[model samples]
Target: MLATIERVLILDRAEEISKMVLQSEIAEEYFRCIYKVKNNLETQRKIREFIKVKEQYEEVQRFGKYHPDYRVVMIKVRELKREMDLDEHVAKFRIAENELQSLLDEISVIIGHSVSEQIKVPTGNPFFDSSSNCGGGCGSGGSCGCSA
Candidate 1:
């Protein structure tokens, strides 16, 4: 039930945060690594191959050991995965991507906690998994962050 002006202000602040993230060193490195992965033809080819093999492996997995080609398909998938992981640019890109994701997760956790620690924000990091703690107490403003 926010008024138009309040909604607009919130939207504006979101835009500002987006800009700040885009300018951060973590974000910059993420973009650089992603660009390298995107432009590398060998990586692109391997990615495509991996996707195809992975899908086939999934199909075989549904049948468990009964699938005649399960072992063969699984072996091929693992081999392709190793190749993909060995690529320098792909490895760097994955690291950068994970770092950026962690940064964004932290910001999300902060915003959620500010409103109320009772709010459950799912950051994949085990250290930030405060969904159960709820800070301290209910609403005495002990640590449950709600300021009312």
Candidate 2:
């Protein structure tokens, strides 16, 4: 019973700390950027189009390299992605998201290392290698093979 109470207290304190971090100036800016993109009709339309094109690209890929339309589909997908990246709102949102992710990753690494040390495990390469490996559900389409 006492252990359960202690666990609840720890969880409550962790949630409080998380709330504090979210209320920080940088976090506020991140949220503002995300909200701006989310609320913009134009951005939403472009994102929808981008998702459609990405899905088409994936479908083409499943046809394998021998498919006659594979090359054409690939080219089209690249062009669509380029146009999406050029959108001011999308680009800004991506930048803000990356910044927020970096902060979270740093926090995760610190905690991971601390836990690893406590368990007598080596803390080499704290985070999983995100390069050349599909971290899964990348949402970027398979254009970047990291999610492949």
Candidate 3:
């Protein structure tokens, strides 16, 4: 266990590292893309529409198939999701966001491994985890020859 002074020093260094990260290329792109997404009128309108549909979808989910509008709400949610995913600004923002996540994950992995190679560091890739049953879409209900 670290002492209070040691913890405070680590936190101060962490803030410096965070500032360096925000100045990096991927982080800069992430900020820029998010700014566009927030300011674009059409995208904001579409997002508002999607939020309304999502709320309706959530309500339908509470009743499952028993809800009279279940099928239609599900379809609308999927379609809206697709449209949002296809938007150029949204797509770029998502890509930057993922890239930034990957960078942070890498940093975490380095820190964890530095402390102890046996420590568990989640990199969001099952293949990197020795305890995972299978890394081939098993989580999506597809059989990957692993007994569940």
Candidate 4:
């Protein structure tokens, strides 16, 4: 009971700190601004950076989820030496491993979907105005608009 309360307090403090950092006016405005890219390569570069950071954070969460599983697996392996039914222990261990594998696959799919969505740029969006054909001279920066 005491441990649970302590954990709850810690998490509450952490969330408060996160809200302060993320909800600042400057941070909100900066993230709201549309990013301008000179070319497809530049756009891709920016997208990659965003994806990398997201993936890193997800990886940390994945590691955290597995910590308890690691302990369970260790216990099961040690129990394999006991006089209990060997088949039952083996089956249980396999089940745990399968569960872990499934979790990893789900995480991969979520990250892939998130990254793909971020990279999908709508045509004619002002963020990439140069790349969109709006009856301009030469595409901006030799991209698609020639209005430079």
lDDT of 1 by residue, 7-121 (tens): 8998999899999999999999999998999999999999999999999999998999899998899999999999999999999999999999999989998888888866767
Across 1-148, the per-residue lDDT of candidate 2 in tens digits comes to 4679879997997798699779877689888888888898987887888888788788878878877878888887788788878888889878877777777766655655566522222222334333214443456777765424
Using all chains and alpha carbons, the TM-scores for the candidates as numbered come to 0.80, 0.68, 0.78, 0.22
RMSD of each predicted structure: 5.3, 9.3, 5.7, 24.4
Model 1 scores a C-alpha lDDT of: 0.86
Give the 10-residue window scoring lowest on summed lDDT in candidate 3.
128-137
Error of 1 at 120 (Å): 2.1
Question: lDDT of model 4 at residue 107?
Answer: 40
Model 4, span 91-124: residue lDDT tens: 3444544444444444444444465633322322
**Evaluation by lDDT, superior candidate among 1 and 4:** 1
Q: For residues 1-148, write the lDDT of model 3, one tens digit per residue.
A: 7579889998998899899899999999999999999999888877888999999999999999999999999999999988888888999999999999988877777777778765666678553544334442356554764443
lDDT of 4: 0.45
Model number with the top lDDT: 1
lDDT of 3 at 16: 91
Model 2 is weakest, by summed lDDT over 10 consecutive residues, at: 117-126
Q: Which stretches of candidate 1 lie over 4 Å from their true place?
A: 131-148
